[model samples]
Target: MSFATPLPGPDGDPLVVDCDSCVVRSPGACGDCVVSVLLGPPQDVVALDDAERSALGALADSGLVPPLRLMTLDDPPTHRDAS
Candidate 1:
């Protein structure tokens, strides 16, 4: 599957899920991820807003659903001159 790019969400909140960048992306992890649980299977990208994220967090906290297991890559390192 292709990596997910951030999308514009409600209130200008950017996308929260980038499965391709996730560090724990796997069949087992996907099954427990909120994206997979709610959206079903994996997709190229999954966009979620602040409200949606909060709601999902609540559900996960209440044990109603699994939390989002998205561990994306860290920020890229800055370049420096060796000379």
Candidate 2:
């Protein structure tokens, strides 16, 4: 599956947040906020390619990483989820 490029996060470089309790963080969603945490400063959103997706998958599963897509996630549909 295609994802996005790995960028620094709004918080720190190599940003890695905890999403272990995320209800939607399972394969489709991801457990931790890795993507966002690692996401670099704000920039035009770019679609991820196959290679990028592989890299993201590996990066998101490390020690403590979560999909930080929320870091830069624009006003998309919202949902209430509990882990």
Candidate 3:
């Protein structure tokens, strides 16, 4: 049940990614997420540091890759349901 690895943010905070706990862990969401785009399918966890996050954001903004659509339970349910 390892949710996320300790990925340090810009300010030394941790950026945790718990895919299994995500409310929007669906095929559609997974297919369009930056993690999936860069690292293939969704795993139990996907860790990314600040630089990696920034790179993904830049890539997504430039339309080179999809944005990070990992909507966990702590976040609002903006994406569609898994069902």
Q: Worst ten-residue run, lDDT, model 3?
A: 1-10
Regions more than 4 Å wrong, model 3: 1-10, 76-83
What's each prediction's TM-score?
A: 0.70, 0.34, 0.70
Q: Write the per-residue lDDT of candidate 3 for residues 25-78, one digit (tens) a residue.
A: 788877877677777886567666667666666677678877666655554343
Better of 2 and 3 by lDDT: 3
Ranking by lDDT: 1, 3, 2
Report, for every candidate in turn, its global Cα lDDT versus the true structure. 0.60, 0.40, 0.59
Q: For residue 81, what is the lDDT in candidate 2?
A: 22
Candidate achieving the largest lDDT: 1
Error of 3 at 74 (Å): 1.3
> Can you list the residue pairs that collide in candidate 1?
none
Per-residue accuracy of model 2 over 1-83 as CA lDDT, tens digit each: 11233343332323333343333544545423444456543244444444555567666556344434443232223323222
Q: Write the per-residue lDDT of candidate 1 for residues 24-81, one digit (tens) a residue.
A: 6788878877788888986678777666666776777677887666765453222111
Off by over 4 Å in 1: 1-12, 75-83
Ten residues in sequence with the least summed lDDT for candidate 2: 74-83
